[model samples]
Target: MNETLPMTGKMNIAANDDWWRGAVIYQIYPRSFRDTNGDGIGDLRGIVKGLDYIADLGVDGIWISPFFTSPMKDFGYDVADYCGIDPSFGTFEDFDAIIAKAHDLGLKVIIDQVYSHTSDEHAWFHESRQDRTNPKADWYVWADPKPDGSPPSNWQSVFGGSAWQWDGPRRQYYLHNFLASQPDLNVHNREVQDALLDVARFWLDRGVDGFRLDALNFSMHDPQLRDNPPSGVPMERVTRPFDMQDKVYNQSHADIPAFLERIRATIDGYSGRFTVAEVGGPDPLAEMKAFTEDGKRLDSAYNFDFLYAPELTANRVRSSLSNWDGTPGEGWPSWAFSNHDAPRAITRWAQDGDVDRMARLSMLLLLSLRGNPIIYQGEELGLPQGHVAFEDLQDPEAIANWPHTLGRDGARTPMPWEANAPQAGFSNANRTWLKLDEAHKERAIDRQRSDPGSMVSYTRELLALRNSLPALVDGASRLLDTPEEIVAFVRTSDQGDVLCAFNLGEQAIDWAPPEEFASARMVADQDTVNGGNAIRDRIEARSGYWAK
Candidate 1:
């Protein structure tokens, strides 16, 4: 296990029953990744074209955002057809090609499964809405309006407004935790659960290595439709009525674990299938633990611990990682500093004029964590959030709450492939779904691919180091006592011990290296270390070091 894995060439991935444990997964937002067919939208073929790029990043797998048949209301989250491919993203042949290419490149492909909700255009929803007594009427969460014709309960949608939508034909209100066009599924129904499981089988049969369950906790809701109680503590940045409520009844239902068991069973029938749920709510940690507990559900789960954090601090890292301290039978955790739904880490965590250094430090921190690390598209390039004018906005949530919410559109911009090419080589079309950030050109893939000091190259080095070290991958991690401005942790395993330290602050700090780490050897570039005293004392601002 002391082999030094290079990031530039073909290599065999660990073919163990638990390859997902501590694996590095690269997340690809299809619409923003790379466009083919000159449609200004990334398609399955585009993913195939970039398979080499992803493989070169040294990640174990790739988690592609939804490309299923959808009306594009919530992008692909509001799936119109569970088993069909979206025409906008090319046909099924293109998908199969991408899967084959990824597998050939030794990269496992994990597609998003949005079973929590479906587009209003879905056939089942259409049939259910046609009449209350239809065969598919119970497929969605439907409730009768109150005597005064108001919503059945006080539940609110995550995107603002009421969670219940009025249907004229059925004369009833349907529950929708997200956009009105996206109706919550009736997972409580045995038939609906079976149907969704069948959908999983379809993809597994098609050779997808795993699934990234989108909002798994949001799949099941309280059958009572009770009004959510208000939070006692006032929210500091309330954007919608949804934020005011505790969100107890609308999400994180107790019945979710049972459904997860069924999903796990289905995936278990297939060889080497992995599942990771995206749990976001009032108590994401508790929900994530429950969803992945007992090894009978998902293999891993990630919460919004670092996704929406305003500042990156020592306490935040310690507190978040502490929740997943590897208890017996406890579920494994997956971590991400940036994703399609959140702002980029460079934009959110970097101090003024320190984006490049912060980017490298963040990669080292992510790879050194005691869980699977998911690198979002363009995160390797250290791309910042793109700026979009109010008039150019396409996201429903951002448009509904302008000037208040930072809007995920900024983070969902196109990936800059070629620094000088039109549209940054994302697509040949002049117009893209979201505006491309001007600053991204400087951090484009072509520009950084050859620069050894570039963020992309640094990411490759850090990932390679992580892959080479068994201690950093599957070892026990303990937070070390350090100043508030610095985060230090010791990872231990049978292989060896590794110490990772980072300065989150802007000013250099004097740090007395632990006796155990006095003779440690550096793993990558010690950009922030004071060469004057070795590891005896000193740390530069917005930099980190990994030593064994």
Candidate 2:
């Protein structure tokens, strides 16, 4: 990628508190971004080195995945120390350099805050598990076993089996919604909540811009230890017990929003701070709204609607987007088609079609949507899910449910920077934690940077277009009636109105826009409506256009 930053059309980060309202955030999985020390793992310095590349993409900010002190059990999700940087990722000074460089490039820096759980090695978890009499005894969820020595409830860990783990020291069962080593924090405790708030302050004091709360819905749980009811929805395959339960009592406690309110208050003290939560469960939309309702809890919330969808159809997109109607008191929404935890969107939605064309179409649709759009590290380059053999897999969840799911390791592979460099320019080391996708080399940054028709170029142009059009950012959106294969919507604002349409199907179709758009000129096109041409009656397969 180019090291020189673009001079014009950069995001203006002037002291606007609502900068994230419709901003685009590029997510960087630190370990997979770039390895500067030849350790085969990305570090803070690597991110600092890549800030120019990220800023040149026209995104307003970057959300770096957790780089806190960890045991690598969940690849930084199971944070060992909320206030400390992991040795592998570098020291606090290195992190400060990242913030300085990113801010210098006019890019805000948002970081992952894993408040839901912590690695068992965490000091708080260690103290809480030690006989349950320490100062932090109640810092984590702990319960007495049933008379029969079974777990307290039927709650299942997302990884597998029971959510409870026997703690020999405390002689009580501790909760772990994920792996056994990742103990769920008792956020219901006022002291625990206060401590978490303090951690947030620590980061904000370091000049960090904001936070992306990891699994915020899983932050609190029912203290009653009630069993979760069956989902009632049938499934063809159940790889883990977690897939069967509705995840009611185990997570999404009613008190989650109360804690979020406290978090919001804490962040509000710092000017321009933004907070967005990752909420997933049986009814995520409801919880997402509650978490961000009235803007008193969080700035925005995003669910797994498009992240885990099997296909990208007009009806599917329409249905998902329709739920977030701009009703009064409704929380702001953020959208992501792919992320570190899910397979690449192109891999999931392209469905053996023209991948390159589909990639451009997806970019257009994401940028034109009303909500804040997140671009995963390699998504801009149209990278697909990397191939991770069973033997090479590192994700515990994927390994535990082998053959049933591809696991997240495929999506967490290193970013491909060069087409022919060693390890594709990710590192100088002999091997990385996860192997680079052989196919990704063809779409590496070096190759795409020079190609005008590449995914990277398309993404940059789309982002610039989005920045230029106020209608595309923080505008009122209404879905338009169109053919089943066409997803159409119009975003209207004081600045102007943008009519967006996409043909997600495999075959071209003849369609006519509403009379209002009859004379609208095409501002952006991906082989659908010709660029700078009047709206046409025919739409091409897997193509789209943005007009005003």
Candidate 3:
């Protein structure tokens, strides 16, 4: 008998199964995850070395933050060379090594591709700004300002200040929805679209499994140069002025889907490839559906569902879930608890509020949802945001929006591996690029990996339970009519049935579930406290439970 026969169970991902469906993606923020050269910053080799740890978590793929060649103003988000890696993170060859190692572990590699903008120093941008006659002048969004030297319109950058910047050479204000140095690409141009597609193909050919497109909704804009209307209501977020506008014309353009389809078609041509968009806005459901409707665009996407804002109350979760409604082919929801752009969920939602229970509840909630879930680095250990002072802040967006916003620096701290090592086991340097909180060492991965009651252990249990149940993995969710204090749902599939419920508050509440959940059995829950068959005649606040 042949040992390598079909029954041996090889991955077959390269030829079979659409890999993105119901996948679990782990997001790696390279700068602070692990430092290999003792340079006080994490690099590609360190990530490769840590691949085993991530793969052990059983994620379907890994979404690596940008490591492209560039100045580090916004870390690697601002790209100088699209096809090559920055020397700071390591060479292009080092990235290839990471890709190869990740594949060996059955962990697909997906990288963050920032296509909406590029660093000012990029050869393409530099040449495009030389003069209007340059081959690439039309390559970016360049327009003449009004006669009064005001911006082309009322558009504002996400970071700060006007979105338009004056260029001496071009004698026009070029649009940059981010920093002046990071100019927005002229995505409306066919040549620009083709060039960007070429960049995507470069990584796909190099064996990448997928891409998590950054600011995908910002890819195209209104061609008429119309002014964006100021938001009728004052922005609830006082930290940044950009949120004050309706952004109807400035972004979320109708033509963006056409460009996305082009990219999707190219991805479809490649075997075993996938694409997910990172969309952030107010009307996320409509936008998400528009992008993924009828398979014409993005494979899946996650929005600001719970990334921002305060505590995850029962009503908020219920409302957010209602937006999806688990309808057929409308759009699939990919959820995230934390990422580089937002505050760490543990600290943002729980931690000080009831760290242990919140950690367990969040883990269970994310897995039970009907979408591909993404877990951020250090989240498994229940690591809280680092305490960063003004001098230690490196993120431009955070710094630009000071006291009004806490800034993302605190959430982007180095990952803790060793409980008592220097630099929280992230680096051996006298000083790290960002401060490592001394308190987090106690919750380091090395310390928690063996503790059954630790958040990491709970995470493993929750993920394992979800994986074991077919109904929870890919199923249609029916929202159960429960109290505002409790959000319960049933996941039904051909294989079996499962129940998911969460008590979104801090106090206990009694509730009767719908008749459908009577046949379900407990699969997993907050380890320290059980919901008792999820019948819970009552449940505590910030509590969660799952039954099969």
Q: Scored by CA lDDT, what does every candidate get?
A: 0.85, 0.88, 0.81
How many clashes in each candidate?
A: 0, 0, 2
Superposed on all Cα atoms, model 3 deviates from the true structure by an RMSD in Å of 3.3
Please give, for residues 24-132, the per-residue lDDT of candidate 1 as tens digits. Answer: 8999999999998887898888998998888887888999999999989999999999999999899989999988888777788899999899999999899989987
Candidate 2 lDDT tens digits, 319-404: 88899889999988999999999888887887875667767778888888888899999989988778999999999988998888
Q: Estimate each model's TM-score.
A: 0.96, 0.97, 0.95
User: Poorest 10 consecutive residues of model 2 by lDDT?
Assistant: 1-10
Please identify model 1 stretches exceeding 4 Å from their true place.
1-13, 233-236, 525-533
User: Per-prediction RMSD in angstroms?
Assistant: 2.5, 1.9, 3.3
Candidate 2: RMSD to truth: 1.9
Sort all candidates by TM-score, best to worst.
2, 1, 3
* lDDT by residue for model 3 (143-241), tens: 987999887888888887788999998899988888888999989999999999999999999989889999988878888878888776555645566
What's the lDDT for candidate 3?
Answer: 0.81
Poorest 10 consecutive residues by lDDT, candidate 3 = 1-10
Q: Candidate 2 — which residues are off by over 4 angstroms? A: 1-15, 527-530
Highest TM-score, which number? 2
